[model samples]
Target: MNELRFRDVSVRFGGRRRGVTAVDRVDLTVPAGAVVGLVGESGSGKSTLARAAVGLAPLAGGAVLLDGRPLPRTPGRHGVQMVFQDPYSSLDPRMTVGASIAEAAPRGGNTTAEVARLLDLVELAPERAAQYPAQLSGGQRQRVALARALAARPDVIIADEITSALDVSIQGTVLNLVRDLQRRLSLSMLFISHNLAVVRYVSDLLAVMYLGRIVECGPVDDVLGDPQHPYTRQLLASAPRPGGIPTALTGAEATLDSAEPGDPHHPPPGCRFHPRCPVGPLVLPGRDDCRDTEPDGAQRRHQAACHYAAHASEQHNTRSTP
Candidate 1:
């Protein structure tokens, strides 16, 4: 089993002085054979992190490690492969599906057989290999993309919003195939998505990102069941619930009227999230701790990078005391 770790990874676009930091000091691990779902809003750096793993994006600082060692920057195959979000654009329009998968196969092998096996691995009909990208449906194209990634025989797969572009009716089928493939192949994955329900269904562990930093991470059940950070609670509250019932967080704290996330090029001081924090100045009024001091990323079984989460835990413990 291979473990993938991002050690304080940071990705900056353009010049260092005025560039936007897409991923900032992110520390995350996809444990051996475990699926870690990364969730956040569209601009939260989830995809940027994935790109960094595959060497598509240059790291401004830090390293991406595979099994405790740094991944090779010069890539043919660094034991990590990425399946991008848009199937329509990800697959080449001119190439046949078989040709696409075979192109990623290791050289000096029976490429045809490998392509057939990969197609079957992704649950595609073997004959579909001859079809062009335009000939396949959205879901089929995605499956082909998965097949192409698998052809590299990678230890870790970075799935960057792989299901978001598919039709709703076909999303479940694709997700199930991905889950099944992971178990059958004992693959470690960093699954990126914005859908809480989808992440809950597919991931064993979850990491929440906001403005290029991880705000919370833990076992999926623990984080989703008892979210620690106010941002996490706000995300959960806004998610659609079964039977149209509201989530545990209700009223003012759950409201989305807080300030919008700041520019990545010029993030706010201290916590970085203080401007939009529901439990900070918005609720506590005179509290400057959130604005004046950056909170360390919580280092525990279930982690949350918010001072208020720690304070709220202390308050709860005090109330429960004799």
Candidate 2:
């Protein structure tokens, strides 16, 4: 069985002293035939992690393992593929969709037959293969990207916000296609997005990133229904609902400033999230522990990096006991 494991992986850009740490000691696994959703804010390093999996980003510390073996920095070292957010930009406007897809197939393979099959797999007409990217809709172009990724026959698929550029209705179609393909092919996938609802829809396991660190991770329902991290809870609360009424997890209105404040280049001391965690100071008041010590990180299947994970639940329970 194929599995992609990121063991204590960390990614930093620029010099050690001045560089920004884009992905902090994050450990994640996308087991064979499972779809893992990674959700977080725009700068949470979700894309950076995905890029690392595909050899785009270099690891500063730790390793990215494929089937328990560390992946080499060279391209195609592991059978991992990626689909980007902008399908239009991902494909070459100069080449026909068929040519683009065929380029990814193994050398000496029947490019024509394979292209047809790939197009069909992505729910596109075979004739559409002859069309240029400029001739396709946003949704169709995205499908072409999926077809190209499929042509590689990779063991793991890293989809980086693939549906973020499409309309809502089109987004659903693309997501459904991904879900169907993942199940049918028994493919391991890392679906990255900032939208909670979208992630919740298609993931078996959910891992939440915050400021380059994985703040929470577990089974999809467990993390979504009972998010252990305050950041996770805040994201859930701020997501807009179908009825136009936004739910508040802590009665605080959603705003641009809801995210924890800290510099990516120079993170805060102790808990990177303590500066903004609403309950950390209250739970561990005047102790300096919350501000001085980072939690022991992930434990077991469900992990949360919070000093208040134990007491926060009790406090929430008490508040809702009425």
Candidate 3:
């Protein structure tokens, strides 16, 4: 097992002065043999952070490290691999699935046997290797993408919304397969998703992002059961319940649609989420902290980048205590 660390990472697109900052000074770690799930709404930079880990996205600041060593800029095989969201686009359309997986095998390895083994590992039939991406269902294609990532023998795998494009019925199967593979292979993973329910199902740790910054992070149970950040609370509230009923947002948490997120090219000076924050000045008239000061990012377990995080936690504890 190998640990992957993103130290104060930032990703900017376009020119220096006019570019948009997709990821802003994020500090996250995928611990050895553990799965860390990064969750957020669309355009919140979850995928950008994943791309930074595998060198797909250039970092404007900070470094991506594997086992305390910086990743090589000129990549051949860096022990870090990514499984993209769209399987059809990720795999070569002209190549056989066998050939696609074989291309990722390390030098001098037996490509034929390697391809079969990978196919079996992902629960696909060995014969499926002879077919093309178009021949496979969305779910199977995603499994092939996972197999391709594994063929690299990577120490860390970044799965960027790998299930979002698939049908809801197939999503569960893929999620189960991914969890099984992680445990059986002892793989370190950074699973990115916009669905809190999906992230909660597969992650050991959970990190929530707003705009380009992480607003809260902690063990899955802690963060989901008692979300300290308002944005996290809103996400949780919007998630469907066990019987497919939507969890209604009430009081301060009901303001998710009151305002849109700020532009990435010119993010708000203070807390980026303040404009739409359910618990900010929109509800608490006298409170201006969210509009004036940036809350500290997650620096410890169960931490949240909100001035009222402690208060919220305390209130929850009080309500739940017997």
Candidate 4:
């Protein structure tokens, strides 16, 4: 069973004139005890989406359901918990680490000893529970936050860049701990990160987002290994590879099959990827609309909003324009 689900959720800030639509129509389902990854760049809406999952961010539009129930407009028992990027910001500076964990003890951790036990689960000595957030390193502080969330025994955990702030060595430890914790506790996780490597390490299913919408999504292996979406391909090409040759993604050429937005409510006419696409120079470089409008980053099974993707396999194989 899926523990958490987002149905065409949309969140926008400010007005049409100035505000940015942070999260566009997004639909995601996270299986109970499954580790799903939500990966994207800084402005790609990963954090906003994660915040929505945890009930910390208001939904400008659409529905968010937890275990088949509508989530309350406010944060409450949907058994959802979040581990933020900066452990220090999430943890209190004034309270002892133990005290902080005890306060949010998810399962009603009633005793100090139980709190210590939570620390043990996260691989902490439980003695460190006596220290404050300032006393612990970034990784250690995150463990404390994890322990606190574990105290609740949450059914769903939204880990938002919890390891991004840590050193590489510490990050590996924390990542392993998260994997171990999920296996032992059967906790469902929506792991959010911009790092493709990290996402690959943690997620079973992967979602690639651009702007505020999901551009492509599929099983981790399929999306990373044989990405069908042009954007996905671009990302893979840009990331480090075995030979370390950076396969550059030039703009994409526009094809006729692309979505055409008749009204502004619709995204825009032709392929959403026509702009900033590498091959656009050859296909429809003369067409200027691709430069004027915003593409709705919507998806249906590794969906590529590029019309050229209609011919991506044939066209992309060529790499450069003829």
TM-score of each: 0.93, 0.94, 0.94, 0.84
lDDT against the true structure, each candidate: 0.87, 0.86, 0.88, 0.75
List candidate 1 stretches off by more than 4 Å: 74-78, 243-251, 254-258, 311-322
How should the candidates be ordered by lDDT, best one leading? Answer: 3, 1, 2, 4
Backbone clashes in each candidate structure, one number apiece? 0, 0, 0, 14
Query: Judged by lDDT against the true structure, how good is candidate 2?
Result: 0.86
| C-alpha lDDT (0 to 100) for residue 24 of candidate 3 | 93
Reference-based lDDT, residue 92, model 3: 97
**Candidate 3 local Cα displacement, residue 224, angstroms:** 0.2
Residue 171 error, candidate 1, Å: 0.3
lDDT of 4 by residue, 1-322 (tens): 5479999899877777767677878888888878988876567788988888777788888888887888887775548888999999999899999889888864543568988788889999978978999999999999999998887767899999998888988899999999999989888999998778888998888888766777677788877866666667666666776676665433332332232322223343344444445555335456454455444434555554444455564565565446
lDDT of 4: 0.75
Report lDDT (Cα) of residue 74, candidate 1: 55
Q: Over the stretch 140-252, how does candidate 3's per-residue lDDT look in tens digits?
A: 99999999999989999999999999999999999999999999999999999888878989999999988899999899999998889878877876778899887665565
